[model samples]
Target: MCSVEGAKKLAAYQAVDNHIKSGYKIGIGSGSTVVYAVDRLAQRVENENINIICVPTSFQSRQLILKNNLTLSDLEVASQLDICIDGADEVDCNLNLIKGGGGCLLQEKIVASCSKELIVIADYTKNSSLLGQQYKKGIPIEVSPLAYVPIKKRLEQLYKGEAVLRMAVNKAGPVVTDNGNFVLDWKNFDQSLDWNKVNLDLIQWPGVIETGLFINMAKKAYFGMQDGSVKVQS
Candidate 1:
């Protein structure tokens, strides 16, 4: 049987192959799955001699661009992108996503919003009938470091779910985002709640920089199945 990592690679390669073009500005997303996308994009740049500029969504993504020898640019230089290829922690039937598992949602969402299209690449495990069905890590909310405690309290009050600070595995403190913000993972949200309203309300809270809830943002998704096949969702 093909491993889940293989599935991620399959989906990523397929998405890049299908969408990447010469002289186009691309948004490279951050995650394990997106590593394959960047690698494939670099291959295309070398083998096909394509002229492309890649805008990174995180520190890791920026390193990937440089390591792969791909042309690196910024959102300022390429304000509007042709396409943004990213991975999601979870994706629902309607294409709503739970991102930021890697702590890069702020830039990821910003880059995606500026793109003409957002294409998601993931393994089959990430596909779900609804949000919070597949991913149990909770919805990651980036917030100001100073307001972490207040934001956590407010989120718990609003959603009736526990919002815990995301701590670093190797460090003694919370996981700091590329933008130097903190993250709170909100667990146990009501499954049947309206996500659009929830997203709007969460973002309006003071100190909330962004939420992991990417509602109605994805234009398409490619999920690699266990059987070594790819599924296209739009």
Candidate 2:
């Protein structure tokens, strides 16, 4: 039997197939869902001769490109990209996204912004009536390791919430991002959130390089729904 996750995965796979094409320099994204898209792209490459170079959002994403036999290129070399496809943790109606659940938000946003087109692929559960509804985790904010305490205090005083510094339990230290920064997992707000305003305010705080809230960036979003259907929003 096809599980619910499987159904959504299939939808994501199909959605990417419909978007990716020949003569396109692709941006491969991070996370588990993107893995399926990579696999599908590889299959197409094996069947047909296509000249495509993929830039990755993170180390893991780069490995996926290699493991799938897709040609890989550096972001510096290929300054322009035709399309970029990635998965989101949560997607609001306006296509605002909560990414970096995989801890690659900074790099992901950089690669996506450099591309001409960005296509977000996510499962049904990721879709939300509004931001902060589906994903309760306030937002993933990457900060300097030394600035964690001060930044956390500011987030609490200013944002009216506690910012939890994400710890690397396995490594017995702080979670280090691909850019050599630490992530603050801010959560548990005491009151209702004005997502648009809050997202903007958080980034203005000092010591914050970037936040995981991707607002008005995606050109197209492919939401994989239950019962094997897809919801498209532009």
Candidate 3:
């Protein structure tokens, strides 16, 4: 049986192997699982001598790219990318994802939009039949700091869920994203709700920056199973 970490690595390695190519610009997503993806990317660069440009989705991802000695670029430099290999907080049956557990949803979505294809890689634990079935963190919403309070209140009333500002583990207050926005985790909402419609509506709000509900964005996904196998879904 594959441990959780092993499964993550398996999915990461396989995704990198299958998606990445020389001369291609790539989007590096943020999160713990993405750490393993960077590791594999570094290995391939070292062994295969493949030259690729990395566009980081967060501060953490930039650090990973720098640490790995990978050539790092930005959207301004490489706005068009070949593909994006990312990890999802939760991947549903239709490949809809609940991302931004790391507070990088805004940038992640932007980079993914610039890319031609979005590839999601994850462990078995993150693979679910429904959006909130396995991941309990809820949908992450990036909002302007000045309007977070009002946005949170409005969203809570609109959707029956505990909408709380996500606090930092080491910092004093709310988790400020790389783009300097606050995050609200809408927890325990109706799972059967139409996320596509909700996401469209939420983004139109005054203070909302982005929502974690990724619909029709990902082209394919790789799930590393506990039984030491990889499952490809498209």
Candidate 4:
């Protein structure tokens, strides 16, 4: 039987091999699971001869690209990307995602949006019967570093949900993002959600750049199961 790690590795490798095209600029995503995908792509680097510009979602991802010997480029220079393969914390049947668990959601979403196609590679645990079933930390909303107390209250009143300031579990104060922002993890949904309305409502909020709830973003998804099975959803 294949180990869980081995299964994840196989799934990522297959996803990369099947999707990546020659001469296409790709967006390399962050997180532990995506590391496997990068590794697999790296192994074929010599043979592909592709002029791929890898846009990283975080410092860790930048290093992964460098370590894998993949070409890296800034988003300013590389405005258009061919594909973006990333990992998600949770993905519903409709392909709505809950990411940013690793705090790279801001950059990840930006890269994904810029790319021609966004493909998500995750373990089966990330797949949910419905939205928010597997991962329930609430959608991670990154806000400006300014006063977020009022923003939190406004989110509760306007959106009818709980917005809690994300604490720096590793440090002393609030968790600061790569863009020097703060993360507000919203919760307390008493009923089924209208994700479309929620997305529109949150985007209009002041000081909010990107929310963790990624709706209608993914073009394809690969879920690696424990039994060495890979499920593709598109």
| Native-referenced Cα lDDT, model 1 | 0.94
Residue 147 displacement (Å), model 1 = 1.5
Candidate 1 deviant stretches above 4 angstroms = none
Look at candidate 4 and give me any clashing residue pairs.
none
TM-score of each: 0.98, 0.92, 0.98, 0.93
Instruction: List the candidates ranked by lDDT, beginning with the highest.
Output: 1, 3, 4, 2
lDDT for predicted candidate 4 compared with the true structure = 0.84
- Indicate which candidate wins on lDDT: 1
Candidate 3 lDDT over 1-234, as tens digits, reads 999999999999999998898899999998888999999999999999999999999999999999999999999999999999899999999989999998999999999999999999999999998888989988999999999999988998998888889999998988888889999999999889888899999999999999999999999999899999999999
User: lDDT per residue, candidate 4, 1-234, as tens digits?
Assistant: 667677677678889999987787889888878899988778777776655668898999999999988988978988899999999888888888889988888899899989999999988788886776767787798988774777888888876768888898779999988989999888875437788788878888788878887888899999888888899988
TM-score winner between 1 and 4, please give it. 1
Off by over 4 Å in 4: 1-4, 47-51
lDDT of 3: 0.93
lDDT of 1 by residue, 19-64 (tens): 9889899999999999999989988988999999999999999999
The CA lDDT at 214 in model 2 is 86
Better of 1 and 3 by lDDT: 1
Model 2, 63-139: lDDT tens per residue? 99999888999788997998888999888777788898889999999999888988988877788877667788667
Model 4: lowest-lDDT 10 consecutive positions: 188-197
**lDDT by candidate, in order shown:** 0.94, 0.83, 0.93, 0.84
Model 4: per-residue Cα lDDT at residue 46: 75
Give the lDDT of residue 129 in candidate 3: 89
